[model samples]
Target chain A: MKPSDIFPTIRPWVEGLVDVWPAYIIKPQFASWQVLHILSLVVLGGVSILINLRLIGVGVTNESPSEVQRNLRPWMHVGVIGIIVSGVLIGMANAERLYDSVAFTVKMLALVAGVILTYGASLPTARADGRVSAGVRVWFLVGLAVFGLALFVFAGGELVNPGVWHMILAAALIVLIAAQGAAPVDLSGGPAGAGRGPVRGHPFHRQAGRLRAARPGKHRLCLGVPGVDLRPGGLAAVHRARSGERQAGQGHRLRHHPRLGRGRRRRAMDRLRLTHEEGPRGVGPSTTPGRGVRSVGRPGRGR
Target chain B: MLRDFLVWLQTELGKGPGEYPMSWSEALLGSLNFWGLLEGTHLLALMLFAGTIFVVDLRLLGVTFRRTPVSVLSQKVLPLTVFGFAIVIITGLALFYAKPLVYYHNIWFRAKLVFIAIALLNILLFHGRVQRNIAAWDTLAKPPTAARISAVASLSAWIIVITLGRFIAYDWYECGKPIPAWANVLQECAASEHGAASLAEVAQ
Candidate 1:
């Protein structure tokens, strides 16, 4: 069924509610709903990224993926409930207008699909394996596709006028394309395969050390521990080494690192864009201090 | 004397970016096709930057993701966060260049900048004072009160900043046009002689 079609059944009821309590949404105090909506988004997006990062084993290495998920799960529920309440209030305030708005309809569909994928699929898999299952990855891409479609329609709402069926067709096409595109990429391994069963030798650690050892002059450390100065060159060198190791180890390491999903390499490129100024820098641990851990931030000679 | 200096600065800057050769570039970017693309990237970057920061702050609050040491999480997520922030900076500047004077006179725009400054200051205070001894609570499931307070402050600052940034579009405060008297104190644009220039001339 078309998105517009599904909403119509309840649109009359919602419109009636709006008519009775016009000031509920129109009054100045209703602005808080907007604030709450945005704040809910902060929580939702925050926890979503946290869990996703955990899945990739990038953040919270000390905690198992399950522990991370369990800790954040309650907050995610609160965020979801807040979003629902705020979202309902917003829709009720301008029911008729929103009912007719293509952007609104698309946003609702995306939010539903996103919720399902997030709570139903992605989180569950992350809870189990500390990594997103391949199936969840596909749905995740579809959810992103729908979300992007909503954004597109919302941004260009005035420019394009499409019927409900047309929007649904477009959304379907987007999901189909995104699923096809994401199918080939292996997201199961996590970022640089960091989440794969922990091998005795931390591959990234060794690569980081080797790269640091190879190019020691460009870096100046405040302490004797590794810090987050992983220049593009260093990461590129590490990327190459990781690729070779993946081939040799075969299935032990991920072929592609889900740095932050698709377009990660572009994001990486942005980080590396400043490489010309800080050439041949050694990749190291972040600068935040942790007692008893070897930080290795002290200045050392370059190879 | 201070008022004069401020007026002169506003008048000069409020002359709009169109006065410079960069205006041509701005015109190109402001085109319907390009503007949409820039906006899309800007939004995406915002999500990444905001999302990453939110997770980091949550860790500081000891709210969740406690298994990982704070230092390690900071190191791992920061590069990507910086990358997202870099995109936002680039796109934000381009957008500003498109309508410098208009944005300059906007109260919401000014508020956004203020919020950003406050957020940065909060970051500084946290890193300079509290973070120096982060190692002690690096693995604590519930960080100390100071860290939690810092986290709360950071989150609040960013929320206000984001809200203000969004409002910049809705509340356009154009130079060469009348604005609220209160806004005049902040912008001094409405009364400036330079404010008399039409938006077209500003685009020129």
Candidate 2:
């Protein structure tokens, strides 16, 4: 059955909610609900930005992605809960108007997609400390493609009407994705280089290579690569393996090195690992470095 | 004096379909769908700006990020906050320029500006005084009283600003409507020729 057919059946129940005392009291104070809704968005959006930044190797590079997610998860929970509660009140008060609004339908669909992506894809990838498996990455991209197609089909070939509210939602999504992809390239010191190709000539890649050459055994903390291990044991093993090669001739001790601080070390390693992965053979960046290959870098980076 | 200046600006900018019609820039921004985009950008930017600031404020208040050093958290998050604020200011001004007279006569918009001023002053207090000595308490889970107080003030001011901003969309006490005397005086409703005409009607 079409949504047009279903909405009528649901409208009476949804509209009935406003007669309840709490919703009824809030019906007149519509602006208050709007305020609450925006405030909750601030919390949610803020926390999401931080988490996504961590996943893509931008801000708070010192902490593991999991740690940032763990610490900020409570705020995200608060935001989601508050948004839902306040949204329900507002929705009930204006049930009739919303039922006819295509923007409303698009918003609900987008919300469902957002919730699923956050929990299913984003959080899991982050929790794994940015080491996304190839399969998961493929599935995430597939999911996004399907969602976009659904939006297109749902709107009957035209994307949605170019209404202000519709565009706002679309713009927010674009900004979030763009910020994730572009930050590594734009922010000079960020670890993840552009994902599309072997950025061997990029200054960050050169700096990372120099750093790795200077220190053989210690792998730079490359969260962007899949095979490189960030765990303590894996790190020690890589150090042991590489130190064996170093013992032949290159004997150096910069233990007191000013540049070898924890954060710098991690970033250098990340760049070096990414560069190594995108070698002269022009292998693509990891299928799922964190969330998806698209998120890690723009399309057609290999060229 | 302020109302007179605003009235002068409104007149110079012009309004309506008279010989001295609305300014081209104002008309373009006001009439087009682009105005809606400007408003949406302002709102989205406000979320980013306020959200990031609240994170920093929470850190200062010792409400969250207690384990993370105060300096590190500030260093990482403040850049995003600054970026967000830059967008907010640009879009906010564009929005104001689109309807300068409407905003000038709006009580809620006026209140929003007052709180924005307070928020700016609070920032100056923070960087000028509180932050200069950050090295002293850089690692503390709870910062000094001055720092905490600054955080509280920042939060309170911005919350009021956001609420007032949302209230601007409502016409509860619009200029032409019959408003309380204090509100009319605060809004300087008698300053503009239009406002004066409306006030005179209310008096009658």
Candidate 3:
């Protein structure tokens, strides 16, 4: 007997695992994780859309490019996770059919490229602070474009081929939803980037942070954590600041707290992004409370 | 009655060219070709459609890039839409000619054309008067009821147009034979001789 013939015998349980539910029908097995997976897709999909658009030449006309990247950076994790969850769900639902689909293979490849590009491009350099470089944007765009093209081909082929229109339509709906969720980016005002300044003085950078913080999901909480700052010096500053805020209460900005920057950093020197910047160069978490919001007052205030 | 009418239409339009008011030129240039051109035009139109629809939907749903004035997006994309749709209509007519008497006699096709006309007329009648109200909805979390209705209608009509057009091929129900009437003669001559005898055929 051929090895193939014996394979099923070897893997005894593999043959009848999937019951005869028409593979085309997206079965509604309501696991807690499935709903969470869908929900994750929504959250991460939206964040991915917003960031990808900013990477492209789409929305947020007035904000500096770097600011757009910073605010949108962390949220991309949600989008990647969403894509993974939704992708796996859909793939499992149509495993037999998708296994042979050229579009599926291409999309998988594109997604892999996208993930790699996102990692490679979104790394924060000391010079750029949290803003992903244009080179990063290029890779990000390639990733997005490849992914988008994969989706378009995958979905479009199904329009004329064996795949059901309903599946294609549903997928398209998800795409549009994700697209709508993404924030826009534009180069109309100037080059889509940020410059080096104290994070205090950089409203563009701050605005990016605020946008992530304002997101109505776990992204806000995830990003709101002190150690998640984009700059190397960000985590320590956030840690100290959070401590001050908790100790001092809501109305008291960090300006009231004094001399704790030196004392705290020496203790927590091996910590987060804020470790270096929290030093007493007079712009410590204590000295600078709201000193850096002026540029954020530029034309697109809602940004 | 509607089903019967549709069945009757299918019976009538299945007849060939000599028995119908359709010609080669009419098929190629006059109607079918015209609408096929719309397929090309639709690419541009689809973008504008997406653009306008995006703004309106976002306004209704309350989303971002909201800072760009709603009126501006409407004005920008609406003109492109109109221009694109003109191509669609012109092309649609060409497509209709590709099998005219059959298409003319097909109830579904007739209904589709009627829907197109209705969609067009609706835009003409209400779009201008309603543009301001629609624009105001852009920044609102919940657009005013009237604007929402208009948005819904606008979206609905476009969706219907697309769906019906697709179904035109799928749910095609042609009528039986047609008499070679004067219009049919014009089309015939146009088919055989490409406008050479169309004037005389029309005069006859």
Candidate 4:
């Protein structure tokens, strides 16, 4: 349904809210309300980007996916609540103007979808063992794509045709989903590579054991290596394996995980991609190199 | 000499790019659709810039990410923050370029510049004075008073900047508009100076 149709029923409720709000806020040009909106975006948009980055597997590698999620969760709540409060304040104050503005309508729809996508798919994927199935990763990307479209429409103005842009965005997302399909889509239901116990002679487990035997200092040093290649997309499997590698000291081969090195990361990406292309369902030896955990990567998918 | 140079600079800057022989600047100036794209990007970049700073400021105040070393977290987030900052500055310049004279005379725009200068100074002071000792207290649940002070200052400055930046859209001192005396003094509000001339002529 179009936004215009939905607003009439809610108009009275919005007017009531506006009546109780501070008098200063009633003015459409109120500076304080505008500042609140910007500030809330700083919180909401910022945390959303960080959480989404982690979900896709490339932020704060030092922390476990769970740790990243836990630490950022409070801020996420604060941001979400702040945005809603400020958004409602602003929306109520200028309900008529917003009701008429297609940009506002697009923003509201995107906001709803964004909140759900962020909290539902992204946050859960992050909280899950960092080994998300490819299907789950697609869910995260879809949320990002939708949020981006909403932002584009809001910024582009209501006057512009959102229909054309929506179609363009949908096509782009479809391509991304199709590209991701080439990688293994996790169907086992649990974390992509969790549940299966440590495999003997497996790279991650073997390294973890070796590191455990080495000087205590080496464990910290080895852990430091992952930091070397922590680019923005360095999300789930590599990091998850890094932790497993740390504990088992065996996630990578003794030679060192190419994923950990800048030059070698492509091999890891290729391996993940190959898993998508080669095996859609069954787990293979190469399905997850470090301990049966496959995460989103393209750098090393060639192998 | 400096005053003369400043005047000369303003005079030169006032020349509308549209009048240039190449006409490329003019073409860009004439395009409302292009400016719309820039506006979209400017807002997006602001979100990124503001978001990164918010996290870093929180960490400085020792509110969250306590277990992780502050340095590591900073290192990881620095690139995104820088990328966001670069985009904001670029888009901001383009927006300013589109209507230089109007923006220059805008009170809120001036306020935004002042706020940005102060924020930058706050950053410099923190990195110079407080940050040297970061290693000592980076892991603490509550950072030292100095770091906390900088965090507060940075946050406050940025909020003011954002507030003033948004308010810049309001024309507090337009050419034909009757403005307050204080504004007149600050923005050279002599009626003869403004007359009924276009903003491009005023810039010249």
Candidate 5:
């Protein structure tokens, strides 16, 4: 039920994992392995701090938010690779003991989540236009807080219990960071009255300004609307009116969907009815009419 | 009749929760030769299982290859990962069949299965909501909410599954007292005395 109950049996096995080439690893006399391990720890630890700082908005304040992100981010990945490689090497020196140590597992998870979140959240938007808005910055802070809390909890776990609880906390922290990283960031610039609103520049930012300025058909092009809100039939009515004006001919080059504006589809349906009634004499389908039907088997058959 | 079957199972497959040396289902997995193939395949299966997990987890965490685009990486890695997964499942089944009872009664092993189930369910969500947004992310700065959550869940589940898998090697889950680490000095807890001592300490 408790960790102590399992440690003794696991100790020898863990020792084996850590002691395979004790000369290269555990021997304080060898100095090299310990040095690598410490170096990895310091580097990973430092990067973790910086990334957390950036997340908290305290560290990268001097740089444009994105610049701060760009600089602090790459190190996060390097730190992860270093920690993993070094941790494994050290653990291998005393593989058996390290393998079974709850302390080690907790450390691994903290590192994993820390590296992942730091790298992921700053992943430039695919549009190459992604920028950090205030909301995104807040998520970064959340991630940073979670990461630091995880590290502290993990260190405490190692110092105190090095039991199931420690590993559980570490895992929880890492998972939290990863969760925050998955949020979307809108890179676009914003609309009027940015105050008392959702961070205005994200994907959902208003398309209202241009729609109002539209000289017919422009609203249709602005599918991603930011501020403009239309009532149930408002958009349709507006569309109907603009399309009606377009039919009057201002020589606008826009591809106004005639079908939507004045229900051209209804007229098309009427034409189809006339064609069906008059049959081949109507012209279009009558000219070729599915050649397969006449040449192959049955007439008036469609492909 | 069902009661009799139940008693029979209790004597055999359905042994006590903390039971061990409860006998292997196939004794020696049906002779040494058959067992060797099973073990070898099991090793291969493990690689598959672990590899898919690594890739999926990496993707979820956004730890991607620099040379490979996200969509490309996903395309290339996913198939192998899924293939490896299939190998693991088949191999795992073979191993389990080779000795169902030990696997069944092993508490840590059962816990591993539970985590794997959860991890698998998380994968289902990954496929459903998250995967759908792959094309859209390029146009939009960020993916949708559902994708983000699925990715996080996938990453978390894999970590838990890995941790639990590792736990299988560490925890002495079969015994009531399982005086494992503490018992480094004393292997078993045959008597109630050690269990009582543990019960007291844990109580405190």
Candidate 6:
């Protein structure tokens, strides 16, 4: 069914509501709605950008995708609610004009596609906590392809007027490619290692330490131990030694080093108590804090 | 004195097909679909820029990313914010170049400029003063009072800037219209006699 046929049927209901409400009667009402719409879009688009960037292993590389999603979920909810309420009001005010606008039709379709891509595909795969499976990755590409196909069919396969769609498609393609390209290298503990890639003898050992420190609960434990150096270089040395032990089949020896040893580390951690007033010292401005003591006892697992 | 210079600058820039034959600003404004695309880019870049700033400001206010240290969030997110800011500035300049006189005479645009100035000053205050002691409160859910105040100032400034920016598209307080005396002074409508005469002609 063509959108032309569908829009006509819905036109009357919209027009009737517009007549009753007459949002345009007030001089500033429609403009206020526009401001609200754009503001909501800022929130929505910003959250989406950050999440997508994280998925591609670009920005906020320290936090796992799942954690980033958790942190941003409330803002996402706010953006969604604000956009919908303001969008509906704007639509009601301009029903007649929007009824015949091909751009508006394409926008609604694209909005639906975006929501699906984000929630159905991106969110689910991200929630996998960097272990995105081959199947899920394929599905993500498929979802992106569907959006492109929708644009082609609806917008007449031309680049005319809908330059925004072209930009969106190009950006999505770049993000997907980057994510896919980084996946294998990441598995081998490369600089882009976002997953649980082993860091044994990696050249980017310092970066690896910073990345690990970015994870929740790890940095706090590192900081809580008073004497142990919490600098990235210091952490990297510990990581390198532990990884070397693992590589040389000396996993058992990890228990001997005071820093890596589980029993001593825990005792050290227990001895130095942290009050909110006395924050961790000597930690650099860029070093992230841990979420809590959740990962204190269980150390050397992911790193 | 500034108003006089601005008016002179606008007059020089607005020279076009008749008198100057082919002016840069005139060419930009006359290009088909270029203005629309420029406006679209300006808005998109604004969203990206403002959105990233919003995230950072929220963090500073201790409203979000409480578990994460302020430094880490800033380190990771500020780069994206800078990227967005670059695009916003570039496109914003292009938008202004397209019609310098109109925007110069616009009350809302003037108000937007004031807020932008405030936002920039707040940013300076942040990086210069508030950030020096960030390590002390890096992991705290809430930052120091100065940092929080900076965040509030930044938020209010940007919000007002954006609202005023949106209002610029409306003709309610545009020049050549019956605006209040104070608004006329603020917009400096009298500074550009040539612009006012041209607008009067257009109005007729």
Query: Which candidate wins on TM-score?
Result: 2
Task: Tell me what TM-score chain B of candidate 3 gets against the true chain B.
Answer: 0.57
> What is the lDDT for A270 in model 6?
45
- The lDDT of model 3 is 0.44
Once fitted onto the true fold, the runs of candidate 3 whose alpha carbons sit more than 4 angstroms away are: A1-20, A23-303, B1-51, B60-68, B79-102, B105-108, B132-139, B172-204
- How well does each candidate superpose onto the true structure, as a TM-score? 0.59, 0.70, 0.37, 0.64, 0.35, 0.69
Residue-level error in angstroms, candidate 4, position A222: 33
Where does candidate 6 clash, by residue pair?
Answer: none
Candidate 6 residue lDDT tens string, A1-303:
234556567766766657655456532488887888889888887888887777655566667778888888788878878888888888877777777666666677677777768776777766776566777677667767767756765556233355565477557555433422222112324336554342323333344477567885453332222123223345434433332223334433433554666777566444232211223221223233432221111122122
For each candidate, the alpha-carbon lDDT, in order, equals: 0.60, 0.67, 0.44, 0.63, 0.44, 0.66
Q: Which stretches of candidate 6 lie over 4 Å from their true place?
A: A1-6, A9-11, A22-27, A133-146, A153-303, B1-20, B192-204
Error of 1 at A42 (Å): 2.8
What lDDT tens digits, residue by residue, belong to model 4 across residues B67-172? 8777777777767788889989999988876666566666788778989999999989988998998889877878889988999999899988888888787765
Model 2, A11-64: lDDT tens digits are 667667778767788888999999999999888888888887677555665566
Lowest lDDT sum, 10 consecutive residues, model 1 chain B, at B17-26
Per-residue lDDT of model 4, residues A195-255, tens digit only: 2322222234346557757865454343333333333444323433433224334423523
Candidate 2: where is the Cα deviation over 4 Å?
A: A1-17, A133-146, A149-160, A163-303, B1-22, B29-32, B193-204
Compose the digit string of candidate 5's lDDT tens values, residues A107-211.
554555555455545443211223455555665666676666556655555333433343465365443332221111121223453332222222222443445
For residue A254, give model 6's deviation from the true position in Å.
Answer: 28
Interface RMSD of each: 5.0, 3.7, 11.2, 3.4, 17.4, 2.8
Off by over 4 Å in 5: A1-303, B1-24, B30-40, B65-72, B138-145, B178-198, B201-204
